[model samples]
Target chain A: MAAVEIHQFAECITCHAWSPDQSMIAFCPNNTEVHIYKLLADKWEKVHVLYKHDQIISGIDWSVNSNKIVTVSHDRNSYVWSQEASEWVPTLVILRLNRAALCVQWSPKENKFAVGSGAKTVCICYYEQENNWWVSKLIRKKHNSSVTSVAWHPNNVLLATTSTDGKCRVFCTFIKGVDKRDLGEGSSNDLKFGEQIAQLDLSVTWAFGVRWSPSGNTLAYTGHNSMVYFIDDVESSPSAQTLALRDLPLRDILFLSERVVIGVGFDCNPMVFTADETGLWSFVRYLDERKVAPTSSKGSQFSEALGKLYGQSKQSTSNDTVEPSKFRGGAHANCITCIVLLRRSAATTVKRFSTSGLDGKIVIWELDNSIDIQQPGYR
Target chain B: MAEEGFLEVENLEAIITRIEQKSRKIESLLKQSKPVEALKTALEGSPLKTRDERCKSANWIVVHRAMMAIKDVDAMFSSLDPEYYDILMKYLYRGLATGDRPTCDQCLRIHEKLTERAGLGCILRSLADTVNTV
Candidate 1:
């Protein structure tokens, strides 16, 4: 079993993000305020509180290279935060969205970001040096329903989005002035701005989280109906494979490697899925090792026997310190909403990740690949 | 009031007559050892749209007969189209709901093979759909 670390944050965390150096953390406590915590010796100390949005914050992303934080909320606005001296300041972006924004993510180059909204559009926002503010360009008329999540491809040009319309689409977000003429190979350079490259209709229900693999060769997303789809060959013919899970639906997913992915959501346990030598995807195991409650059958039986010998003495059952009623087996007691990669050994392989959810607890999990417990089709 | 009730009864009778006709054709195909064609005919024009219990049960009997008559599970699934997987799952659930020992056993046997052939999405879609209840 992997080593597990737990932290108590708030009543409920809507979303969270880690700093570039992994020293401090920021999260929304299911409210309008965003709290930034600094690690102080053995406990976390509240260092900053960002209060600008009038509604609940939905998504937050801390840029890895430039060390900037971007946040979106249901108030149809987004803010980019930068550190000045000892305080963080917010720069408002004119998203021009009429409805609430659902999710946000920065591009691989940190030059732009995308915000999905209930207005059936994605706002690709970038810094404007002349205006001294961030401006957005709308990709409209492609999504017929509310856009739920957005993920950027590694090439920094192609953006993948999932929506309530039961479709995942890959669109080119290349702007002439902002993007270079020639990206790397397979950068989808020929497509115009906002041109959709592919639309995958594998789910019959609302699709939620979406992530592109490290190599940008495959795309994965989850549906409300407890199904996950992986599509390959995005620029050309897109082929898809669907894996239906028996547990509750997943809200978010992260690609640990090119072959491994960790999915977390309503099941309250992080699930791992891996691909084999033939590239056949299958469910492997859950990261949550449900700890056996202290009240084992043998212990219960002994207590019962002792009670019988003592002629119906009630103290034996009540003497136990651990309340069995509140003892849940898994680490999380509620739905898991977000998962972020905390540490990675290399670009392609992940070493550590953190998951937080409605339970208001953040659980850090380490991946131990040395065991090679490749129990394929074990589900 | 009596006339409207009588018209609904007549509509149900017509639906039952059509179902029985289809059932006869499916039985004939099954006798010829063509279970795939029999299953295909059984799934067409399912009575799930109608709220009448008689029409649904009559159509379900036809579907259950065709499903149980098959001997080779893999051969039938190999030739089956993906479009029919969801409908087959619905009928299988209905068969299991009947609570008969042999019927449930047969339904579970087919359900396992169906899930293996068509991923778990087939079962999820079948269960999630509220419009087409068998």
Candidate 2:
């Protein structure tokens, strides 16, 4: 069973981040105030409130290894918070942008982080010990529109940034003092700071989500055209292959393995896709499709609700067609905005993953070993 | 593997049911000769629940065509999803008035930069009107 908890009522949760131990959660309730809550006795206790940003907070990412919370906001500023005694202290980051910041992400190595902004810039921010504050370098030449999301490469030197221009661009964010070595032999960039070498524009619609594969060999992004594309970073000019999807467009995605990925969005469910024997990635099955039967309708005078109340209906029994139910047989009530891969010992399989969304629910779903996704159709 | 575009039996049934329900509303409005209100409900009833930009944009694109089918951009805007008012404005600013992309599919074509952020045109005009009255 998937354990789901409703955090707020009718308010969209813009973004969320969990601590390393998964005991505490930091989320912005589509407001300027950032709420930090801890898990106590199977219930969430509001531990502290970090009220600083003047505008609504856009995104939050908790650094697992560093125990720091970094947030970017519509006010065009970013802050890193660390617990001191009983309160959280906020250190201002010099983003130096003209427009609102959309999202923030920390690198795996925890030495640096990246912020995607509406100013068509991805600010690769790092702590400047000399000044005792974090500062950002601008990557603005290639992107022609607002950058929506940013993901850090596994090596912590590369950054994948997506924008409204239907393109996903990768930049080498190697700061002199932060990165000790040069770019890998397989990387396409020139190992220079803020140089974009791999520019794979899907040529369909904007890419709102981008994730670097765990191995850092491939980059996957969800396009606005209901298409998922993966770019191999090894080629002189990285080539992108679109992952086939017959359903609605995906908003967010995560790499479960080098070959398998989980995409969640308007579908109100998480879908698992895996690369075939020939290395072609294909949709495997919906991990949340627990219902095999149609819902029972209210017999007499019928008026069923619609909107974010139900999933996209597939098919049903009886020739007349039955109405879709509110999150009937699915785990989420509405569009899933984000998915976080939980603690896992294996690279190819995920023991657990959590999803939070517009429905105001954060759900943790555990995977069953019986449904092996490597097989073409696990269902 | 399942066939392309293949939905499960239950899903298909529920989808058909939802379609039938909307069709009934469209039919009743036509019978009452209030196609504008009929179209208004359709546009207002859009799936903002998707929250995904592509899905939300796609839903509005379909509603845009429905408005074009009725040829009443005013009524469509009157009951437009406030969340998508900017999307519709951007669609118009880019002169996608014909409801056809360069690729000719439902794929995205117009640039979001084309929008005139709360300028004299679009809803800002109505907002100005209300402000004057108050």
Candidate 3:
């Protein structure tokens, strides 16, 4: 893009989720307030504010239909917000054991969610048949440490969870009220429970983030020492291979497309990598490495010199080693905690991508093919 | 006596003026590459205690002016030399470990400059680990 315009800047943006339709972004600034901004009239404006959480909001996700939003917070509660009577209201509240809920995600096809928390528990709450809202189906997993992150597969039939114990587990969703006696004799009740589909042992002691690929066949997770591991053939072999990635402590990973992955590293650089079906990987670009002119006086000469240096280097490097100049500055005032990219139906155009950092600033970058990335002044 | 004190003040003013004029002449002489004359005059015409003091005074002015010209943390760091960056990193590491917010700011200033010279990839992950530990 020629220039990235800051649509809305918050002082304490804790978490944000984009609508599946790419028309709105719902954000929780800290834990108590949730704001929804609609992209209309050529700008983003607040459409809803949810003020129900009594503690800091720790996790947020949007439903597949974009009609509902789920949030979990340190208040040990998970809430579902739905559009009702032209306003957003808390349609459901699932109270868990008296422990802080760290993350929540909605199932792709069904109105179900998986909530992970500090209590070493993973609760699967679904919409009740009689009531219009949701109810908790608490599953007390035997995890030694707190669950750090959770994700529901696109099929809505599987859930992936990670913990500080350095293990990634995939669990199959079990239908509610299903009895073990109905299946067969000598069948264990644990089989009636969500089956642990797979588990991966990691070298690092902590798995801070975990995400399933869009195809639901592969998984990617990040942990200590800046390691990002990718598990392919999760369904067939139950074995995972570590994908070679640049050495940086990755904060979060998002599958932008089947082949392209976007990740934010602890070093504050947003990286785009492409992987083939065989698991061979290639680094596409480092978003923060894009050259831009210094906006101030003290480093103007240095910036110019750097730009010239890059230009000279670009000339000497082979075409395969060089990337398009369309990269923009991904600099943040503090450590980047999260990143989300929303693609339009065409997938060629990026509707909006946001990055929030420790400095409490959330920036929305709008991309258009018409804008040239080669302009040195475009930051 | 009061009259004697006034006479001493007048003499001091004259000495200051003379020093100022001589310093300007020395500056011109240095600019013209007359190093011998410039060094001799700077040494003999001024009452300054040592060359180190003169250098310190000059550095203070440079620092004050540089600070004034700077607009942000990035600007402040971009102007610093490599030596300052090294000192800054040491100070920042110490400050961050102590949980001193003021030291964090100071370190951040140095980091901003280093980030300008280098990319965020060079310093961010290490800094994050340090902060997290603190």
Residue-by-residue lDDT tens digits, candidate 1, A207-289: 99999999998899999878889888877888889987766789999998888989999878888888887778888887775
lDDT of 3 by residue, A294-328 (tens): 33334556667766766777778767234544343
Q: What lDDT tens digits, residue by residue, belong to model 1 across residues B71-103? A: 888788878887788789999999988899988
lDDT of 3 at B26: 65
Better of 1 and 2 by lDDT: 1
Clashing pairs in 1: none
lDDT of 2 by residue, A27-69 (tens): 8878998888897997788898888999989989999988999
Q: What is the lDDT of candidate 2?
A: 0.68
For each of the candidates, give the backbone clash count: 0, 11, 3
Per-prediction interface RMSD? 6.9, 16.7, 5.8
**For model 1 chain A, where is the 10-residue window of minimal lDDT?**
A290-299
Off by over 4 Å in 1: A290-328, A345-350, A372-379, B1-22, B25-61, B64-124, B127-134
Model 1 residue B129 lDDT score: 62
Report the C-alpha displacement of residue A266, candidate 2, in angstroms.
1.5
What lDDT score belongs to each candidate, Candidate 1 first? 0.84, 0.68, 0.62
Give DockQ per model, in order. Answer: 0.16, 0.02, 0.03
**Each candidate's fnat:** 0.24, 0.00, 0.00
